[model samples]
Target: MEATLKNLWSTVELVAVAAHSDVVEQWDGQTLTRAFHWAQYCQHLFHRFHDNPTIRRVMEKQLQLVNESVSVVFPEHTAVSFSDLSRCQHLLLVGLLHNTKLPVSLLRILFDTSSPVNKEQAGYRNVTGLCSSMIECKSACKVLSPLVEVSDVGADAEVQGVLLMERLEALLSQSREPFLDSVLQGCEGAAEHFCLVIAAALLTRKTAAAQTTLEDFLLDWLLHKHSLLQHMCYTLPASLLTDLAKRHVKFREAYCNVLKKWASDMEYSISDGEWFQASTNPTVSFQKLTEHFRSLSEASPSLWEHVENQLNALKVSDGDFDVRGLSVWGDLLSEIHK
Candidate 1:
């Protein structure tokens, strides 16, 4: 038994028990520092005694020690107010961000403790920025899945271009009003990045169901979620889907399916658009879309202009709305076009 881990561990047997709540809570700073010792001991014990199970148990303990230490050293990091964070809060956030080795457990603590500010949309944006900047996308998404409104299509790291896009898709599929608009730009940029990857996939002949994630997200959301038919026919219908499909012709049926669903469910009307407007300014969302499908303009002369014109014409008028840009396309012939 190494002296560093020995004094704290108390038992020679490294075959671990999940640290109890009391053990984690009461363990002082000195004991917590022994975590590295435990990790070191686990490495040595695995080789010396060839005790794999015992070492594995001890490794779990070490990770738990690190996780708990994070909660102790910087308490209430993710739970704090998103708006007007104090210097202490800034320091705490920066501390977590600085630690690249953040575990999945601590990430869960961040989301679990935090709550969205309903009336103040900025709060949601602030938190989303913080999460995206600090937390790894995959870890953040796994914790956020239960919060999603729907998700039939799963994630694909290779296809989405980046792992974050998979998380973004799960987020955008939801009917979460207060946070949806704020979160869409994250999705748009992610969608764009993945589309670029898909474009390259087209060249390599490496396309597959796994590779066509963005298309799958759109189709699955529209098909199974059912909210898209009633809510998204105008914005998500032909404009965005067409450009996405062109990159990979295989998903054209998904695009056509969205439009067809929108047509049949025309009777279900609302004076608003779906999955389009990200913020108070339509330009923000439009700019994001253009960035994502920037390939569209390159593909054809008139295509980008048409999409831009349609988006520009609409104004998010006066309403107690959860999302921005309500006045633009909600059954407006001028906005929807002939």
Candidate 2:
């Protein structure tokens, strides 16, 4: 298994390069068949071990790397390659539909069936473009098109919000346990990513239903408050929500409310024991704490200050603030002082 894993990753790297390189469309028929076969086999392994962190991480990383490399041109490349666009499209489709199992509804939304789109056209066009491309020429588009209901999607914000939320729930439920496993791993990375994903999904519509959905989701996040603070105590996440709030005031307040609780918990968790601790490692090193904060602060200039000012006023006004818990699990304050 280990040797196969090694060669498998090597093959993945080579396949990614081919999927992205200008040379792809020119590959001999034999080479093309082998590449597709390998990718398909890998997809099978991915599904078989969907619950295995080791397998999921490797597969997700490879697909991410492939997409990034294919979509972006390196500085070294004298010119960009769009010729392999079809091949890249094919692999990406198989990866998402077969490998990732991304919800079909959203994919359809990203690609409008009334008019088909290619990747280049989609990127330049925004969601308008993204919703237009189909796939892999394996006729996944045919399998997928019936799922879209694009013709039914209209300018109904409430309905759009409803549809979007349904898709979001599908996405969330797909790997809920796996995602929670990562969340419980002592880092805010997964929860922070989840927040961003939700924010993007919710903000696209302008409807009362959309507003209610956002409110509900934010409230639900209280369950993951500790996870939120792991990334929130710094800047980007806070700043991001602040910016998002300009369009909806509740977003700002609801987000700050969670931070306030995290701060309150931090004030007590050091001596209170483990009721609130989320990490499997109950202990946290100051170095990891500082490093995490530093990365968040650097994500945006002065973002830390803006978020801190708002949250500090909310959590520290009682004069009970403490830094000790921040170094430990479930808390988010102490790392700043040291």
Candidate 3:
């Protein structure tokens, strides 16, 4: 048993090195297949030797090495590269990472690494472009797409989606501050990519199940846990919100609820003068907030009344006197009424 375990561990190490090699030629169908086989074998060994600590410890160490290698190599492959071969390799690496059940920390690294600084840059273009192309290809739409297949493991779109969410939940439970900071610091598309991935995952579920999952994920995990609603309201692009609304009736309702919560929060902030102190230029903040409200109202007329009510009730005052003279609230209110 010891000899067999040593041989298996050596093979796993070799496969890990080859998978992460700088030589793009080292990555191909064969290399990917070997990775899957090694991962499966390690899983099998761990389970089969459930009573044997010696074997389990060795296997665990090997798996940790594999995860570490992936963490180091992923950023290199995901870097701005238009080469189809490099893209293909990157996609394959993603498959292996998922297959191995990547830890939440490594998954966070993947999210941070792929997140685009802006829509025009390579990171944003790569993620969105890759997703679009994968959909067009009609690949299974697994979290990473069909460029690499996991059908042998019996993981369909729904299962993959759930797994992705589980990892996200784990990450959120650990700390949301860093995650939010990543998004707020110009990594907004990371949030959008997450939405795109989840939407794609929902494509395979029956309507009822999909609706329930989307609502719980959006409300429970995103809105309540991470305070993503604020980012959706002010930072993230409207197109992502529009796409999600179009995806499902439940999504639209959930989004409106998010907007309601945001409005409530904003109202409190305004009433308490926190809104003006939120930034150096309260005028810019007010303009963006109202503009977002306008877009949402146009997209979903049902929200117009709620939006109008919020805008109409926008009154800012300091202690005894109205702060309208000290701030641009009056001018902003006039623009809104127009």
Candidate 4:
């Protein structure tokens, strides 16, 4: 299973590269037959098809036709390859980051089926992009075509939030038990990951209905596990962090502590034309920041709000704010303020 999945990943990588060079207009019957065989024999292996640029473009052009008939006509599930392309993180990231307009409602469903491990890393990354792209696309489309509904999302935010909250609940609910088969073995790391996913959901909140899920997860699910706050204040974009800041005093303290830590940790430069350099590795610092945000959002209710305030203050503050000193974080914070 693993080897086949790996091989298919290699093939998908080739398809991604090919996407830049040429377009495959149509698949002959034989190619279609082979694709069907691959799908039937390797459902797990074929997930990587999401990364293919050519395939995604082809799918988008045929979306209306394929969406209506393929699933039923290909009851053997052969035509799932195109749907699989919507789920690929690398390809999805390109679309999301580069602002490619492709229907990605399938992503919500694809993520539902992703493994917890994948969900924590690449899945979270893709979801972040998906939420952003979906919002951008919806807004642009609403302007371009007023009569058409902008969002075609079927997955409710509350449901998505609940599912994510449950994972954190599993870790906290089992904290007292032995760590034999639990995700709590690395609570710190897991909490960080949870924040990233939660932030993705938070980024897409357009209506009261969408926010209900985030609010419930925050107020009901996260507050009990308090340690998560200290992690988020340092990690997530300040704007996103502000969501939690309005709720928790402890999270506020943690946010201040993280800033204090960052300030104290920088090595003072004395020479002429000097700039500050952090004693801690910048990459590690950024990772820690992400982990902090994830942890706080998963465990503390108000950390996001607190983070946004901190970020905003930093943006407006005078010389005390050394922008270039904090490389990765500075760039991220700059965008949030913009």
* Candidate 2 per-residue lDDT over residues 146-193, each given as its tens digit: 665442122232233344456445533443333323333423354444
State the lDDT of candidate 4 residue by residue for 1-338, as single tens digits: 34644545444433342232222223332332233233333333233333456654544445444434534433332222444432334332332223233224433422233322122332223232334445554456445554543322223333344455444344333221221112223233566555655544444444565355444444443345444544554455664554444443544564556554664454434453233435543423433444444444455445446655665565455334546544334443544334
Stronger candidate by lDDT (1 vs 3): 3
| Candidate 3 off by > 4 Å | 1-15, 20-32, 40-191, 196-210, 224-236, 239-285, 299-302, 311-332
Q: What is residue 96's positional error in candidate 3, in angstroms? A: 10
Report the Cα lDDT for residue 218, model 3: 42
User: Model 1 — which ten-residue stretch has the worst lDDT?
Assistant: 79-88
Clashing pairs in 1: 314-328, 316-325, 316-326
In candidate 3, what are the lDDT values of residues 134-232, reduced to their tens digit?
A: 343344544344554433222343454555545444543323233323323333456544444444444434456545554455444444533454444
Model 1's alpha-carbon lDDT is 0.36
lDDT of each: 0.36, 0.44, 0.44, 0.41
Pairs of residues clashing in candidate 3: none
Give per-residue lDDT, candidate 4, residue 278: 54
Per-prediction backbone clash count: 3, 8, 0, 25
